[model samples]
Each structure stands twice: as C-alpha cells, then as structure tokens.
Target: MKKIFLALLLGSPLLNFAQNKLSGVVTDSVNKPLKGVSVFLPDIHKSAVTDETGAYVLQNLPSGTVKIAFSFVGYDTDNRSIPINPGENVLDIQLQPSEFKMDEVVVSTVFNKLQSQNVMKVDHANVRQLQHKGAVTLIDGVATMPGVSQISTGTSIGKPVIRGLSGNRVLVYSQGVRLENQQFGDEHGLGLNDSGVESVEVIKGPASLLYGSDALGGVLYFNPEKFAPAQTVMADFGQKVFSNTSGSNTTLGLKTSTENLKFLVRGNYTTHSDYAVPDGDRVTNTRYNEQDFKTGIGFSNANYSGVLRYNFNALNLGIPENGISEQTHSKTPDYPRQRVYNHLLSLNNSVFLGNSKLDLDLGYIANTRSEFEETATPNLKMQLNTVNYDAKFHLPKFGRWESIVGIQGMHQSNTNKAEEFLIPDAATDDFGIFGTANYEWKSDVLQAGLRYDNRRISSEAHGIAGVEGSFKSMARSFDSFNASVGYKKNLGKPVTIRLNVASGFRAPNLAELASNGVHEGTNRYEIGDPDLKTEQNLQTDLNLEYKNDHFEFFVNGFYNFVNHYIYTAPTAAQIDDHDVLRYVQDDAALYGGEAGLHIHPHPLDWLHYETSFEMVNGKRKDGDYLPLIPANNWNNTLRAEFSLKNFTDGYASLNVSHTFGQPHVGAFETESGGYTLVNLGFGGNVKLGKAAFNVSLNGNNILGETYIAHLSRLKTDGIPNIGRNIILGVHFNL
Candidate 1:
C-alpha cells in the first residue's frame, strides 16, 4: 500500500479573469520537508511536484473550485477541492500514514463521480494493468472485460463489439471527442495509439440520451494520460516482442508540468511479418507496419481552462489475397496493400460561471485511405473529412437534482479519387439537443434523460437508374426522439440492484443509401436503396451486484426490440461480374445476458479463482438468425499473489476462454465450431535507482489450436486465426 497526504486552501476571491498562482510546501509527519511529492489540479490539467526544498507552485489556474490530488510512494492518496483566486496565494500541507485503497473517479457519464456512487453500471480497466498483461493493442486488452469483444479481419485490423451490436451502432470517444473514422466497413479499425492512454470505461447499453446518434449499442470512452505533477518531469520507454508474427512494438513518451501549463508527447512504431497458423505455415500477405504519435498542451486561468491535442496515425496493411504459403518474414508487403493515414485535432474547454459551468469541445478529423493493387497507382481511394462540436451547461443545483442541458452535432463530407466508385460522393449534417438529470437520496438513486436529433444526407449522381440500374442524385432526411430512465437501490451493505429502460435511434449512413458496383475484396455487388427508414430501438436492462472483501458476484441482462433494421443480402441475379446484393430493412429483436463470480478464501488470501460467461441471441421478425452474431463464451482464471521484500506487487495467473459452437447463423453465414484456448501471464514492478520499472510475460493459444471465428470476414475462405503467440514487454519510468 502507498501513503500520501494533501491540503486544499481557498484563496481570496477576485472578480476579474487573470492568471492565478498558488505556492505550497509539503512536509512529512515529522515536520521535515518532503521532496518529489506530486501535486495536481484535475480540472485544470496542471500539476507540479515538490522541489528539493519541499516547495511546489501552481500557475495559470482558473478562479473557482478545483479538485487537487496528491500522491507519493509509501503514502495514501489525498484528493480534495480548493478554491482559486486571481492573485498569488500560499498554503502548506502535512502528510500522514494510512492504508492503501484506490479511489477511482469516472467521467464518461455527464455526472462526474466515483464509480461506487454512480447509478449507471459501467465497466472500467486501467491501461497500465492491461499493458502489464502484454496486450498488443487497446482492443485486445478491452476484450478481456465482460460482455466486450472485437471483430477482427486479422491481428492488424479490428473493431469493437459490445454485447450483440457493432459497426456503426457502437460509439467510441477519444480525447473527449467522438471518433468518426468511416466505421461502416468491416476492415476499418480504431486508428488510435495506446502509448499515452490512461484508462478505458465501457457503457454496455443504449446511451442515446447522452450521445445523440450511433449510441444505440453502447459506448467506449478513453481517457488520455494526465499531465505530470507540478515541478516534475517524467519519461517512460517500453518494448514488446510478438512471437507468431516475428514482430516488435516500441514506444517512448515524456511529460512535464509547471505552475499553470502542461505538455506531453508520445511516439510508437510497429512492424510485423506474416502471422503463422497452427500447421506452422505463414498466412501470405498478412504483414503490416504502423507509425503513430500523440501530443497535448494545456493552459488555464481563473475563469477558464482548456487543452489542445493532436494525434496522427499511418499504417501500411496488407489485404490478404493469397493462400497459406511457405514461410517468409519479409517486411515489404504484397501488391494488394492498403495505405491509411489519419489526422485528428481537438480542443476541450471549461468555463466557470457564478454558480454553474459551461463545457465545450471541438474536433476535426481527416482520413485518407487507398488500396494499391498490381499497378503502381492506387486501385481504390477515398477521403473523408469531419468536424464535430459539443456544448453543455450545468444548471444551478436545485435541491437533490443535478441537471445538464447540451447540444451536439457533426458535419462530414466523403469523396472518391479512384476510378472505381464504391459509394458516391456525399455530404451529411446532423444536430441534436439533450437534457439529463439525476436525483439522489439515502441508499437510492434515480436518473433520466431525453434527446432529439435531426439528420440530412445528400449524394451526387453516379449513373442513371433506368439503363445502368445504379444510384442517381438523391437526398434524405430523418429525425427522432429518445429517452431513458433508471433506478438504483442498495439492498444492504453488500448487495445492489439497478433497472434501466432506454430508447435509441440511428439515421442511415451514406453507403447504405448510395452504394453501387462490386465491393472490393468481396464476391458481392451491392446496390443501395434510396428509401430507407430510420432505425429505432427500445431496451430494458437489469443488473445485480454483490461484493465484499472475500467474494464478488455480478449479473447483467438486457432485451432489445428494433424497428426497420437495415441489412444487405444476396439476390437471385448477378451484376457486374458478381453476385447481386440489395440493402433491405426489417424488424428485429435481440436478447442476452452475462454472469460472473470471483472468490478468495480467508485462509488462502493469496490465492483466487474467477469465472464468467456471456451469450446473446438475435433474430429478424421472420425468425431468421442475424448475421455476424458472436458465439457464447465462458472464461475462467486462477491466480496467486506474493510480495518480495524490497520489491513491488507481483502476481501470476492462468486463464482459459471457451467459445461455444455457433449453429445459429444468417442465410449466407456458415456455422462455426467450438474451441478453447489457454493463456498465462505474470508481472511485477521493481525499483531501480530511484526509478520504477515494470516487466511482464504473457502467452496466447499455447496449444496452437486451429479454428475460425464466426465474426471473421476471412472465415468464409477457411482461414484460421493466428496461433501459439508469446509476448514479452518491459516498461521503465524515469
């Protein structure tokens, strides 16, 4: 356990918006000055550490209440609120001894509070711990959480799936900005770097009231790394080795914070050869390389605070077209490779009024994707640019109710540069308004929200409909209203239950409305429909939890009914040298649940056992199974912990994940077989010359099983997933 101490002081109030400074000294219980004590203001993203003289200063802070947290080794964490004014102020703090228990704060929902006090059920994980487990990517680490999974084209590309919904239904928030990366395609993956990310929070059900559109399935929110403590500068370096791919991933980052300003930067690079399958044969054209960078700068004053961030990602991914071949570990990819680049910039700001606060966020994203076939020029090219904005005002609290009213919207344009046109050039605009509130009382919490949205989509003509049977110039408009209500009750000191009902809707994307010609890398030629109704759904969720020092248990269930669900399927005729498919709509329903338990006996406190299972079923109104439905899964883990004198926390775990056979599939989908894989990992932190270093070793599919996943696009080609991979990583902070 670590021990820490903190003290917050309120400075004299000032009416003007000017720079404010706070200087303080930190001392131990013995009255001796302590050096290297970390001090931070969460709301302003500015922080500093005590110098050799036990003195710390915070500059350029907003004039209002701010949350400051102090932490150090061998001390308990201290966090509290302090008022800042427009002039210089002085305060001193003393440290004390206490036991260690982490107090986590959640920010995904509008109500920013500790998870223990939040009414909504959320799943969260520490990125540092996930890194310790040697997860190669952010999605891979998130998949370990209950009810969360990823749909993969291969190791190099994947998208997140929550419960039973994926693709455009799930929303991802990064750096306080909604991520828009042409997510409608199966080959598109989240173009993000995990180097400087701090944590992840997952909402497993409908969240349309908070987020206007594309929240019908769920949400994944990523929190970037915080600024360094005041008076301190830090850097971290890490490297990982991939056995199956004969690859390497390396990252380096640095951060610094002063009185009123903070900055951080990170760079990462990855290169991998073809991935090896169960039979020791390499999957041809499965190699890739990536380069990514992220940086941020923060500034604050008495009246306002803001941070500007930028992220750039470039990848050269090989789109597999050949069969299994003799082993080759070349870095140069095959002919049919894809080159993708993304530039994202965002600004987040907060303004404090007399008794309320206003929050604003702005973001812009530019994506360029191209495919190079046999020729030197790209065979397919597409460029997408989007700008989005969000604003919210927290109303003055009245009694026990906390409320916020907000408006958010996005403007996007899509254009094609190659001769082949998959989807015509299109422009879209969407806007929404929402208000949410929470009522709190002794042992019970009530929450509700309402939202309304309008969307317009316009596409340029590609060809005449009568002769070519293709899409012409078209336009469409859609609007919908959504609402949600939830109640949380505490049964006792160790039991709790929550019930929630929510409604959500989604407007059709441009591809569904104007797509024509054959889809690259697939056998189907898709024809879009100009007339598609908006999709709407209602879901009811129930959650139960029982937790204590020795044991933990949880269960979650949900049922959803949707009207006018859109899907694409094959027709009776062939078009453009391929099987014809048409976009269609129907009513659909889906229901599923997840359950888990964890135990640690009193006498054997160092040993633990855990297990969890998840399953979902989806069907159309005609009673046909839905496509791309994930199979039922069961996971088990056994672990033991031990502490070494003069060393840090250490643990070892053995795990197994079993996926049941998927006999229920769509008309064109094939049944998948069941399979189980074993995984093992262990890691520990060590202190070396005033620096902390972490090391971990993890193994996946140790037995090298050969199997196909139901959601894999390559499954139809009888391509098995990667097998028998060992990963080793080391991270050192200085």
Candidate 2:
C-alpha cells in the first residue's frame, strides 16, 4: 500500500503541472474573429493562428518569463510580456480597428478606442471615417460610435447628440480650449473641419464633472499633431467621386523630433460639388461647396509642451430653384444664395510639476454668415467675434486619488442687420469654474466633481440705430455636482462586468429660447420663449464582456432620465405660409443598448467574420417616442485573406449595415423606412526594402440600389436616394 500511495502522489503532481497553459482570444472593433493572427515569441519561433471560433490554443507552452506578440491584417499589433508559473492562464484581447484613410496599414479605428472595463468611455476618429459616402458633415463620423447620433437639419449641417442630449447639453473643445462658436443656432456650422485634426476624442454620457455645464450630453476634444522633423515631410492627397457629388482633398504635413525640441505643422484643402441621386435626379434644394485652411506649431521639452494654431473655413450654398411646390418636382437654374466664413486662433501651454500639472489655453474666433432670397432688398448677414481663456491643473497620485481643477472665461459679440429676424444680434459674457477628483482602491474607482456657471446674454432688439429693436439682457446662473463609481474583476472566468451612473445639468442658451423667425433652409418657422429653464438629467451605463481563444462578445446598455428636456413643439398656427413651432421642454426618459461579436472558423486561415448592433428608444412622460432619435441599426462584416509564403498578402472584405425606421414629432413626416447598404473592399499592404504600401478599392452599395433615410429632410421631396460610390486609395510609409 505504501508503494502504491507514493506512485499516486508522484503522478498527481505531474498531471496538475500538465494542465497549466496560457491562452487568450483576439477580436476587432466589430467583435469579429480574426484568423491567421500570428502569436509568437520573437526571441523564439513558438507561434500559432486563431482557430475557427477566432480562438487560439498553445499546447505545451514552456513555463517561465516571456513576451507574446499579436499581429493581424487591418488591425494594430499588441505585445505583452509576462511570467507564467505552472498553471492555466487566459488573456483576451480586443484589437483596435484600422483606418482606410491615412495609413492603410494603420491599426486603430478612426476614433481611438481605449481599453478599459470602466463604464466611462472616450472615443476618437479621423477624416476618412467621417467622410463615408453620403456623409456630408463631420458629425456623420460620430454616428458610427456607441451612444451617439446626429441631428440632421440639412446634409451640410448636423449636430452631435449623445444619449438623447444635444445643444447646450453638449460641449465641444479644440486643443483643450472651448470652441467659441454660436452653437445655440441649429444652422450654425460646427465651425470645424476634419482636415486639421490629428485626432478627435468624444467623451460619452455626462462628463460635466470634468467639463462644465455644456457637457451634460458629453464633450468632444480635438487635438492636432505638432510638426517636427523625426521625418522630413509627408503629404496626403485624395479625391473622392460619388455618383452625384465630387470631392478633392490635399494635405501637407511636416514632423521633426530631436533631443530637445519637436515641431509639427500641417495644412489641408478640400472642395466638393452638389450630390446627385441614383435615378439621375438631383435633390437640388441645397447645393454645397466649401474651402478650409489650417496651420499649427508645437514645442515640447522633457517637462513641458506648448502649441499654437490658426484655422479658416468657408461654405457657400447655391439654390437650384426659387421655391419647391409641395407636390410637383422640377429643376430650376442654380441661384446664388448663402455663404459662411469662419476663422480661429488658439494657443495652449502645459507644464509638469512633479505629481501635478498646470495647463493654460486662450482662443479667438470670428465668423460671418449671409443669406439671400430676393434681389429687392439687401441680403441678411450675421457676424460674431469671440474670445476664450482657461486655466487648469491636474494632480497625480495623492495616496490613492487624483484631481483635476479648472476655470474658464469667455466673451462674445455679434453684429447683424437690425431686421434679421432669425439671427439674434447679441453680446454675451460667460464664466465658470469646475473641479473633478478620482479615487481608486483595489478594483474600484470613484469619481466626483462640481461646476458653477454665470452667463449674461444681451441683445440690441430695442436699441436706437436711429432706433434699433431695444436692448434686452438675459442672465442665467446654475451649478451641478456629479459622481460615479466602477468595479471590475476576472472572477476566475472570461466574464467581465462594469457599471456607472452620473448626474449632470445644462443651462439654456439665448438662441434656443429667444430667436423668432423663418429658417428657410429647413423650411420651418421657429420661435423661442424667454421663460425657458435649465435642463437636468441622470444617466447610467452597464457593460458585460466575455472572451476565450475562439470567440468574443460584449454587451453595453445605457439609460437616461431627464427633466425639462427642450425641443421644438409644433403649433396649430401657420405664419408666412409656413407651419410654426415653439421651443419647449418636458420630462422624458430614454434607454438603449449595443453589442458586438467576433467568430473565427478554425477550419482554415482564409475566412472570418464580425457583427454589431445598436438600439435606442425614448419617450415623453405621455409615452410618445422622442423626435429625431435614430432607429435600431445592425452591421456585419466578413473577410477572406490569402497569404503566400515570403511573397504575397491579400484580403477581401464585405460589410453590410441596416437601419430601421423611427418616429418623429410635429413634422410633415412621422417615420422613416428601414434600409440596408453593402460595401465591398479588397487590397493589402506590400513590403519593399524597409518600406511598405497599403492600397484598397471599395464599392459602396454594390447592388446599385436607391433608398433614402427617413431622417433625411430630402424625404419630404420625392427625390430618389443618392447613388452608389466607389473609392480607390493608397497609403505609403517610406
């Protein structure tokens, strides 16, 4: 018996040691499994490919300290080195999406998708993704992200909305400075172009804790890369030709980084013509054209960085008809109509102070926009000039906590025709102070913040020019406190969970509550009320993720409850032959969810797929679906890649997206119909003597089908949908 017991004990130890292994699953943004993904120790030749379920298993992985590298086509590579004892280990990784614009071989989505199990999420994107077919504006790119959408007034003008929030409920920043545009106006330009951005970060849900009052919905942060000579200079020029619209873009970039100094400067130009429909028809109510320029300089040292930038953009629209009859469809000669010009100057500085940092920003902006209809009287023009300043401090590691505190001040003045009804002639001054602190212990993170804002709005409505309208001044003051907590763990399995909730508030701006007149561009009569109050909201989010060697999936959900949510309410009255609407707020609630999956079929290295879905629903206290909310959407992608030993690399991918119809309030339309679009892409990168080139061709709407989104103002017209498009582009790194 003693001899048998000794043999059993010896065998048990060996069995336990043999069961230990290192394993993980890999996926892309859409949650699709990747195959032919190379996992290896470069110092050694141990490697493997993902199985059919997008899973990979390394058998007999030697126990010890080593690094593992992950590389796949169209995705960024990741390397993690760790020491493993004799035991089973699992690590799941989600790879960032690649861009088709700047660097074909670039890994990472247009927006930088960060890796965090926390409920608070931030994302970024570049111009290529923002300019997808039928995308006529910058906000369009943001629509592809989770918990985000665009409020469409016209193709060229769309506003970003986050979790059923927009307007004053949201804030925007460029290079860490407030964007001083007249954002209160629906037709106001985003006053930004994709050309000058090195990257864009979108903070979803209420970040009012970090930003101030306007961040109730979220904040958009833009950062431009500084020019320096790590490399002499590189240039990117692209031209896109759609069935109906044609666009041309050119960019020149320079970068230099040495021992003590780094400089980066870049400039861009773009122009586009009116778009057409699949049936050879032009939805000519509004034709678009634009020109933009930007210049930036930055200096950096071991402990500090400073940057200065200037940008200008102009937009002109031509009308094809004097007016459209509600029923008959006809084309008219192109007529000169409206134009907008904008310019901005910005400066920013930051310095490290041991465990804390100090940053400062200053900016100035000038804008002029004009509209013309009849040749009888002079055209109406609106002009604005604004300046902004901000100072902030961020402290690192104070025990288990960190803090960010800041103060901001802004002043704006507007000039316009006394009779310009839609555009308010006003002067505004604003001031705010905000602070946020974060605490972490073990697996839990807690965040808290507060902000106070004082604003004054004055208009020359009754002043005498001989006698102008009169001077009317409006002032608003408000404060908000926000807090959230998050927890994460590995639970001895692949399942992960995260939850967070926050409180936020938004102050009403002058335009949403004071403007009164015609907005011919969108064919709606608008009016505002001086009795409007600030809006307040509570938001929460939950997420769950699972991963293994062959499959990966994630689910996310959000809820928003708001008081005094402002929207335009339709009235029974009609003025100047147009329906009238008034801005008003109501108690409302919203809920939505998003999910993604990646599956790799291990039978072969050539085939793989991914799928994602987003859905949202909202209601007023009375149970009516909210207006301007996008319907549920689903997107899927499939790809096949082929590799030849030491020589050729190639791949083909197909993507399809579907959007369901949605209901709206107080409009000639109530709902938009569902539609699906498909895209086909093919190409790969090639290596040549320390240099490489990435090239691809995409055919969008391969079926040549025509369909219009219900959100399209064009739906009111019987105009057919925009036709299919094809794009061929290349990226080279030398």
True lDDT of residue 346, candidate 1: 83
lDDT of 2 at 510: 65
Q: Write one digit per residue (lDDT tens) for candidate 1, span 493-528.
A: 789899999999888887788777776668887777
Put down candidate 2 lDDT per residue, 26-136, tens digits, no spaces: 887778877667665422223556766677765444354444767675665676545555668787778775321111111121111124423354555655544532344
Which regions of candidate 1 are displaced past 4 Å? 1-41, 47-103, 464-470, 688-692
Error of 1 at 69 (Å): 6.2
Predicted model with the maximum TM-score: 1
| Residue-pair clashes per candidate | 17, 42
Model 2 misses residue 36 by how many Å?
Answer: 21
TM-score of 2: 0.77
Top-lDDT structure, candidate number: 1
Please give the lDDT score for candidate 1: 0.82
